[model samples]
Target: MQQIEFQLEHEFVELNQLLKLVGLCDSGGAGKALVATGEVCVDGTQELRKTAKIRAGQRVRMGDVEIQVGSST
Candidate 1:
């Protein structure tokens, strides 16, 4: 699996935005669709909320990519 560390400038980022920020999906709409189809997971659990608040220390996985959210600093 490909592991990516995402640096957060704020306390949290929305799920769809995260996907786009990490280049997981081409667009926000695509990210939302991926989440709605149960293709996204938050910390090992299938996450369907497109706008779910993703904070630092959280792990998001979709297909073969795993993104680890971390502080910007």
Candidate 2:
């Protein structure tokens, strides 16, 4: 599996935006579509909410990619 580290600039980040920020998708809309397909997971469980608030220390996964969110220092 591929691993990526993401540092949040605020309290949280929207799921679709995160996907876009990490280069997983071309845009937030595309990320939403991908999430709607039920292919994304959060903390090992399926995530269907495209705008789910993702905070620091949370893990988001899709296919072979895993994004590790961290709080900005």
Predictions in order: lDDT: 0.95, 0.98
Error of 1 at 59 (Å): 0.2
Please, what are the lDDT tens digits per residue for candidate 1 over residues 5-55?
Answer: 999999999999999999988999988998999989999999999999999
List the candidate 1 regions with Cα displacement exceeding 4 Å: none
Which segments of candidate 2 are over 4 A away from where they belong? Answer: none
Best by lDDT: 2
Model 2 pairs whose backbones collide: none
**Per-model TM against the reference:** 0.95, 0.98
Predictions: Cα RMSD each: 0.8, 0.5
Clashes of each: 0, 0
What would you estimate as the lDDT of candidate 2?
0.98
Model 1 residue 64 lDDT score: 94
